[model samples]
Target chain A: MNMVVCIKQVPDSAQIRVHPVTNTIMRQGVPTIINPYDLHALEAAMALRDRLGGTVTVLTMGPPMAATALRKALGHGADRGILLSDRFFAGADTLATSYALTSAIQKIGESRPVDIVFTGKQTIDGDTAQVGPGIARRMGLNQLTYVSAIPTIDQEAGEITVHRRAEGGVQVLKTKLPCLITMLEATNVLRRGSLPDMLRAERAEVETWNAEAAGVEDIGKCGMKGSPTKVSKVFAPSPRAEKAKMVEGDTAEAKARVAIDALAETDPQLLSVIARQPALAS
Target chain B: KSKELPEHLKAYKNVWVFVELEHGRVHPVSWELLTEGRKLAAALNVDLAGVVLGPSGEGTDSAVAEAFHYGADRVYLVEDPLLENYRTDPFTKAMTDLVNTHKPEVLLLGASTLGRDLAGAVATTLATGLTADCTELAIDPNRNMAATRPTFGGSLLCTIMTQQARPQMATVRPRVMAMGEPDRSRSGEVVRERLDMVEEDIVTKVLDFIPDADSNQAQLAFADIVVAGGLGLQKPENIKLVKDLAAVLGAEYGCSRPLIQKGWMTADRQIGQTGKTIRPRLYIAAGISGAIQHRVGSEGADQILAINIDPNAPIFDFAHHGIVGDALEILPALTEAFRQRLAVDRLAG
Candidate 1:
């Protein structure tokens, strides 16, 4: 029943802005937090552990400062935190990231077998949602993604049933144990840490693993070398030239009337279409 | 300039688009990819093909025929009952098997829920690189595909290339590409492949599918008119104003990502890059600031009317019409105005 939750530290996107004149990213002074979607994954893992009486291990691959994110996870009820950090692991894309994380998970499984692996559906910064499936494929585990709910888990039978979000509907899927799951966001509320959990979080030592210690067999596959995808250029989106034709009025009511008139005038059929829907007109 | 094609990947040829068919309906994004894939295939001097995997039925056959109509020179078909429900195991295996058997130089898929899930697994199984949610796709001098997508929270765009990977893969979000007009006279060869795996080998089973009830879900993608609210609405209750306006016009109502993240609206009602790409005839965005992510989704609207208190809001830059006032106040007024206008027209008619 042991679960491993992978989280990442990302810059608070709300605070991230582009320079007006230079059009360069203004990243300075922004604080880093565990990816918002990962919080839902962490909460899902903790809930399962709380109900099943097992351990939840928080894992992350980032710089040394990323230990803070792991500590935050510990405070939020993760039993242990592991940080996979090394200079060789820098500039890794989702492929290389999954390689390093999968190796670290294998090393963790050497002590206690991992029954399930949890990750967010996608990171706000990367937004790829590829790494989790990459790890699952490499590790030969079932990949369950966009999971909205875990309604039942049968440890004895080695099965888990989940509600997955599809294009037009929800799919109730049942899979075997040892599956990797990427949780959809806002499925459950994150729980607050108790006094004892915070105290323990402060005292707990975060395990830091280098590439070799994490059993990375190939150094070339650990970072940029292993990444097949390369970014050729980064640029800001070009803005459109046409500005909105603003409707002026002293009051909101007048403005509304002007806007409606403008829309109807611009597209004469709009009024007729609205009137045609009798249920809407009344 | 682009790096030379690696010696091992030199044999890879043709461009393939995964034709996503479910419940006997082909997802529009699949056809859109075929349109774009035709250009890429022409640029590379290779054939454009469509890959259809579904149960043995008329659905799969029609998909193959439609692929030809939409500019595909050939169609790859793998029909099996196991491929029906889109389990990750069977779909990934089928796709990876196809790629290994018939090496495609470039593969395109829709950035839908099913496509994203399947692409990730298939790419990983094949140990190839994949670019997700690509906004642009092109072939360079070296014949390598360049996939450009939004990065860093849509504040910037990054062009990614899978330089060393064979069968370079990318997923384009729906509505990002133009759908090609189907030519009924067009025809193509269908190559049928068999999925070796059986039902027992696939660990995951689709226990049930609960289709979204008509009343409970917002059909934003096909709506002719849409009214969306944002954080500028100030409170959850203010959303009633947006619903009222939409009701008057017989339009769908949606909201920006923040409202969905804040639990004020359902995910289906979210209009943005990560949510839904809507191409409504008229879109009224109240209180939205038009971030690049949101713009990518709603820019296809024929007319965009932005309402916000800030004249400097980014939404104004792209909106066809705008009003500088609080949406909280203006939305109710607009609702009343539209209601009266429609009522008078109804009476006259």
Candidate 2:
């Protein structure tokens, strides 16, 4: 059971701040890390590999610096790392990104068969949970998204059962092998790399594949040209003209009282609604 | 180079909304899309239709009728038992088949779990582009559908267009669009379609469904009053303050995305673009800096009270009422004040 986990190196969004005047992202000095959600995906793959006698291959498509992310996945017990970086892949949207990554996965499959392909539910930057489905569709694999748990995997039977998170409940789904799975966040805690794993990861020779090596058959579909959806414009959200009505008080308690008073005065119905609650009446 | 819509693809017309139905009830987002779809259809000078796919029963029939009541000029029905529980394989096949046969130019769906899951598969099968979680939808000058959504974690908005794809697809999250009134007297044409797939061919099988227990779940989307905490609370124990305030106000409590990621709050209690799109009358946000994702979900509230130690927290920009103090301290104070006020009012009564 060989698994391939896709990860992305993204700017830490928490530290990212928009400039006050320019309203542009201040990228200076901000550190980059493997997407938090993808860490969970990587961890899931590693856990499966540990349970079953198999190898987990980590894959990423980005700039040369993206190799760092792959190495980090190696540190977390991935068997191998592959970085598909090319100038042609720049400015690719979800569709184009999936195409490039899927092509690389195909190229990887030429050498070794892939039983399962794993991806994060979504990237923090993209937040569009489309890539996993796109890759699955392109490769003709069944997609199990928002998957919270992989309860069992029958390699001999070529089947896997997973608990998928849906709108109002959990759907326990059984799907065939050779499927694509997008892991939901907080499903499992990520494991830290031990000293030997860290050392091996630091010295690991990360495989670098260009567009041609990645077996991208169509150059047109590799980047912006292949992307059907185009971003026409990007702009910051306009601020509201009226700032928050500042409730002034010398102390936190005083401020809380004043805020509550102001809220009650503005919306008296709130109090009446509270009074109607049977639990509150007691 | 600008490519024109090929002659073969130019035949695609009409704007269709996927009327989502589950457990014999229609999700309100379907009506919301119909309302917005009506505007887009009118803009494109095309017919507005609703596509309802479900098991053959009263649920499917009512969904088709309700589609007509909610401004759909026609309804496309694909009734099959395979679509009863919304396994991706059958729903995707049914939807893609309908699109390929009917050739609607614009397809809309709610960004709910089912819609997102189905839309991706359909769009990919059709080899078309799809924009998810769109906040705005309109027809561009080129007559193509322009879908605008938050990008880069909601720091910026980007308008995306399917340059050369037929049946331009987009999914708008629930509550983003305003729901229109249903004209019960209105009726639409019902075009029933047959899905050829059987249960065995579908790769995935639903073993069981564990319905979310109402006792522990947060109904933040429909709550009248909501008190939410963010990472600013600093500790998991501080969540009690937000809950206390919500208890006194007889409201529901939720948290920001970070809290959920940190495992401090459950996924259902998360209020954001990805979680629940809430339209509460009064929303109290504590220790939240109002990131774009969290802001989009809570901005629909009639009144927002934000408390953060950082005076320059982004939450203040849109929040109606703000307190520049530590939420850890302020939340307890607010809970105490609300408790006292409620107790006094009870005694007076």
Write down the lDDT of every candidate, Cα atoms only. 0.89, 0.88
Clashing residue pairs, backbone N/CA/C < 3 A, model 1:
none
lDDT value, candidate 2, whole model = 0.88
Cα error, residue A208 of model 2, in Å, equals 1.9
- Candidate 2 residue-wise lDDT at A14: 41
Considering every candidate listed, which one attains the maximal DockQ? 1
Q: After superposing candidate 2, which stretches have Cα over 4 Å from the reference?
A: A14-28, A249-282, B214-216, B231-240, B257-264, B308-312, B324-349
Instruction: Give me the displacement of residue A186 in model 1, in angstroms.
Output: 1.6
User: Please, what are the lDDT tens digits per residue for candidate 2 over residues B1-349?
Assistant: 6758878899899999999988777989999999999999999999999999899899888898899999999998888898888787888888898999999999999888788888878887887889989989989888999899886777777788897989899998888888889999999798989989998899899999888877657878878788999998999998998988888888889999889878998878999876898987799999998987888888988889999998888888999999999888898898888888878887987
Error of 2 at B335 (Å): 6.1
| Candidate 2 displacement at residue A259 in angstroms | 4.4
Q: What's the TM-score of every candidate structure?
A: 0.93, 0.91
A254: Cα error in model 1, Å: 5.4
Docking class of 2: medium
Q: Which candidate is the best by TM-score?
A: 1
TM-score quality measure for candidate 1: 0.93
